[model samples]
Target chain A: MERWQVVTVVVAGYLLLTLLIGLFAGRRVSASVAGYVAADRQFGLLAQYFVTGAMIFSAFAFLGGPGWAYAQGAAVFYILSYGVLGIAPWYVLGPKAGRLGRRLGFVTQAQLVAGRFPSRSLSLLLALLSVAAFVPYIMLQMSGAGIVFRAVTDGHVPFWLGAAVSYLVVLVYVLFGGVAAVGWTNVFQGIIMMSVAWGLGLYIPIHLYGGVGAMFERIADARPELLTLPGLNAGGEPWSWGAYSSAILASALGFTLWPHLFMKSYTSRDDDTLRRTVILFPTFQLFLIPIFLVGFAGVLYPSPPEAPDFIMPHMILQTGLPALVVGLFCAGALSASMSTGDALMHAAASIAVEDGVRPYVRLTDAQQRLLMRALVVVVGAVAYYFAIVQKQTLVFLLLTAYGLVDQLAPPVYAALFWKRATTPGVLAGLAAGIGADLFFFWQRDLRPFDLHEGILGALANTLVLVVVSLFTAPQPEAHATVYVEPEEEAAGATVEAVA
Target chain B: MRARTARRLAIAFFALYALVLTYPGVLPFNRIRPLVFGLPFIMFWVALWVALAGVTLWLTHLAARRERRGR
Candidate 1:
């Protein structure tokens, strides 16, 4: 068989397995809101760990990790910084969120914030913003799947078709099983990705440069700057330590605010489980080092006349490895993309249902499940459209999503930790941060003080939140207290309190 | 305190150490050469941190089990 033919069969077989797993997981779904959204909060530590890991690994790990490593050299360390700073805050915040989620039966982050502030409109607005942010993020994952398919198949199966095939598998299972399907499938995909990543990380460098150290030495001899911190383009006015550090900080702080990640906190069995997952998350980060090595190898071997994102895939293809090994590598990349896509698809659907639809219409348990399934298809379709239309570098698209979605952090942080944080304050902060981020991103000439656009936006957002919240009366303690109490305790309360 | 809570705290501390020790910019040294496990000093340190996380979790689970029996 031709290489592309082999690639098609392997990728198709992988998708079939994902579909099978999704269908199988449908048996576990309970016929209630909890079952549809949070897997009835029964996910064990291992399951939660894998799902969280897979959620983050996404296309960024497969494509952006190596792409940045190849293009920017040592500056790619900023990517690693995220895992460190990101999970620490989650140890405290995620448990609190989880506890509250259990107490209030909240399905989405917007619901949590809205419930805390006693503002239905704010929840609806956040839902809208989350969907907008998630669409671009989902697009990046779909586009990544497209890139992988195109590369492996030598363009025989076009990007859209490849994306469609994988997404079809995801939609089939997710539509039936909901969060159960997403969580279980993520476990399978996460294992495949981590195993393949470590195997490739060790094997590729050894095959290329006799050993890992030798690979570094070869790159050092050829282009010494590639191995050093601050990287080659440092003196260029566009990049700086201030910009890099601030960007890393913003990414770490804002990471938990993503609606999908927030939802994961709700799925944990308890506070301890959430904490354990955060602690073990670095093991996932350790796997990325070898993936980064593939990009470093690119410094020794020049990229062909194609996109820079193609460098890692091309390196894997040209490694003279067996066809099965190459197929497995493709599967790993696919796993990364699909795992992320499934989570985003589920989150987007839940946001639409719980936050978007619930306020307007009284939805029964069965009706909510039906609505979630339909919304999954809708979210997938929107993302598929962007994947087909917008073909940009994965890094650029990802950074833009990171910058925009990060605006949610101020409100999220305030809701959890600050009692004085009011609805109007959150609204003002979100507006300022999102507006500044978009302005700076679109009009590059207008970036104030040579900082990352995200930093400026975050600062403006924080300032508004502080000033506005100080002036505004404190939110009713009754509104916020519901979230902090245990579920059984809160369950005894009258419906009027929740309403 | 519940054994589970203690175990969780241990895991959190281990994760915190790994976060600080492995961060690229935070680390003061570059290319410390006397290797462990055929990896660089920094990589070795990180691997130990990862292992420590696992060990801490195991210990915490044991403590939690013992506490449960006492209760």
Candidate 2:
């Protein structure tokens, strides 16, 4: 067979395998809303481990990670620094949230927070913000997939067709199986992504530059700036320490609060499973080391990719590796894109129906499930449209999304940890935080020391939450105790905490 | 270790980890030469901290488990 044709066959086989696994995984869950949204809360440690890890290592990490390393230098280290910082908190918060999820039958993050605050507006606001943040993120993933397909196929598969075909598979599995499909598919995709990353990451440097150390040595000799911290900005100018540091802080803080990831707190079977997942996250996180190495491998190459994000696929094609390896690389890239896309679509839809629509409009479980499935398709189509048609640089939207989600941190901490946090306090804080974040985001020149807007927003949000809570009447003692101490604490010594 | 102590230690460890990796704390270690594990010093520094975070978490997990058993 011709080379591209053989690669096409391999990719086709991989997609078919993912589709079958997703369809079969769907059969494992019940028909209830919990079953669809939280996989019946039955995922063990292994499933939880992969689901969380794979969801975090999105197309952005796979493609943009290398892109950042190749173009922006040590700017990519910010990505490396943030994962463990973000997930370690989950060791405590996940189980606490899980206990509440079981007690109150909450399926989404908004439900958990609003269950404490008890505000319809809060729930609607969270749902809208999550969906809005999700659209650009999902668009990034879709375009990431399109970029890989177009690169690997030598333009035979256009960006639109590649994205549509791949995401159509994602839609089928997600619509059919819900979170269960996402979990199972992530396991399969996670393995592929890690293995491909390590294989190529090590092989490329060794193949081109003799060894990993040797590659860095050459770059240090030639382009010394790329080897240092804070690295370079998008315009290839030296990056500010303020930008670099705040990116890590803001991303780490906002990491678990992303609606898609936060909802995973409701999926684990037990507290131990949740705790172990957090412990093992660092191992999965180390995968970025190889990812960055691959980008560094591209630094001194003769031919440049059309864009920085295309460096990985471009390098693979240029190296003239066997078609099978190229095809597998394509599959790995798709895995990164699809794994996260499925989770985002599933969470956005669930949040929309459960927290957004269900609060104002009462719906039966059957109706809720139907509406969520419909919303999934709607969200997918919208993102796909932006991915193929507009093809806008979504960096602005992605940053704004993180800043917006970071605003959720105060409300969440208030709900689970602080006894005196009033609903009005949480609401007011969210508005102020988002407002400050947007203001700084637009007026970059006014930012103090080039700090990320998310960091500024978080500070504003926390300050408002505290001050407003002090001014407002505390939640009624009896109602607040359910969240502050919980009824189980009265019965015996329990380790329930949100620390 | 007591459960509360374990939790407190874990919190302190992470707090330190975050502090050490950001801005001024990271400035000292952010260099190109003196590669460790065939990686840049700054990159390796971040990875070392991440590994330590895992160990700290495991220790805390063990402490919490012991507390549960004692209860």
Candidate 3:
């Protein structure tokens, strides 16, 4: 058989297995919205861990990560830095949020925020912002899938067809199986992605340039700038310490705030499951070190790909590795892309139906499920269209939006820890943050020691929230304390039981 | 393994990780002249912290588990 045929055979087999996993995992799903959206809160330790890790790593970790290392060198370390710091805070927050979720029956972040603040308008605003955020986010994953498909097939599969095919499988399993589909598939995909990544990551360098050390050592002798800290900025100029430092901070702050990921609180079996997931996340984050090795392996090679993001697949193809390895590499890339893409599509549709539409129009459980299923299709189509038609602009938008996610940090912290936070204060803070984000984004400028636009926005958000909340009478102490100090509620329950 | 202690451990754990990512920018750990384990000083520094983070969180998890049992 021809080499491409072997690749086709391997990738085809991988896709079929993904579909089967998707279908098999949902056998226990009950006939209710909770079953569909929250996986009946039954995820175990390992599944929860992989679901969280695989979702966070995404296509970016597999494809874009290597691309960054190949192109920007040490700059990619910032990606690794933010992931651990960002998720560590979840250990404190997740169990508390999960307890509150059980009590309040909130499955979306907006629902949780709105429940605390007691504002439908706030829920409406959050619902809108989530879609705005998810569009580009999901599009990024789809575009990654498309790029991998086109490159792997040597353009036999065009961007549109490739994206549509992968996402078509995603929508089917996600439609049939909600959180279970996402969870089980992540377990399977995470295994494939991590193994393929480590194998290829070490193999390419050792085969081409002796080993990881030799590759970097050779690069240091030839092109020295790539190894320097606060490496080149996105524009290829020497990155300032100020900008590099804040980008790392902003990324960490924004990491867990994504509504897509946050909604998983309702899916955890208990607080311990969520906490264990957070504690074990660093193990998953370490996979990036190998991914970066793959990228750095591409440097100083006489010929280079047209773009940094293409390095992983390009090197795989060019190095003339066995067809089996190339095929596994393709599956690995697809695993990364589809794993995250499915979750994004799933979350966005759930938010649209539960938070956005249901509040405006009352719907029964069956109707809600139907609407959410229909929305999965609609949302996927729109993102797929954008993925094929406008890849560059959407990715640019995604980069800008990471900072905007930091805007959620202030309100979330208030809900979890501070008692005096008010509804109006959060609204003011959110608006101020988004406005600050836009102003800096349009100017393409980092401000105040080159802190990320998100961090800058968050600073403004916090200031507005504090000034407004102090002036406004705090939400009644009883209402505020329910979320602010859930431990009190637990103690009250114990007291009642004793009586 | 008091719950309070486990909570504090979690906080300290992240604080140490943040310091590694943050101080490196200010202090500039990017020297490649000396390769530790075939990685640049900065790269090795970050990688070392990642492994340390795994060990740290694992201990915290154990502490948290023991705290639950003690309760």
C-alpha lDDT score of every prediction, in listed order: 0.77, 0.90, 0.83
- The candidate maximizing lDDT is 2
**Candidate 1 CA-lDDT value:** 0.77
**Tens-place lDDT digits, model 1, residues B1-71:** 57767856875774576345433443564343554444444444544555565566556656765785786
By TM-score, the candidates rank as 2, 3, 1
In the predicted model 2, the residue pairs found to clash are none
DockQ of 3: 0.67
lDDT (tens digit, per residue) of candidate 3 on A1-499: 8777788789889999999999999777887888888888788898898889889878878878888777777777888778878887787778888889888888888888888987778888888888887888888888888878778778888878778888889999999988899999999999999999889888888889987888888999987888877777657788777777777788889888898888887899999899889878888988898888888888877789767777888888988899998899889888988888899899989999888887789899999999999999999999888777774632244556687788889989988888888899999999999899778866655466776788888999999998999999877777878898888877988999999
Q: How large is the interface RMSD of each prediction?
A: 4.5, 0.7, 1.5
For each of the candidates, what fraction of the native contacts does it recover?
A: 0.03, 0.74, 0.62
Query: What DockQ does each listed candidate score?
Result: 0.18, 0.83, 0.67
Ranking by DockQ: 2, 3, 1
TM-score of 3: 0.97
Better-scoring candidate (lDDT), 1 or 3: 3
Candidate 2 Cα misplacement greater than 4 A, ranges = A390-397, A487-499
Residue A412 displacement in candidate 1 (angstroms)? 1.8
Can you tell me which runs of candidate 1 are displaced by over 4 Å? A232-238, A302-305, A482-499, B1-71
Per-residue CA lDDT of model 2 for A293-380, tens digit only, reads 9888889998889988898898899888999999999999999999999999999999999988998898998999999999999999
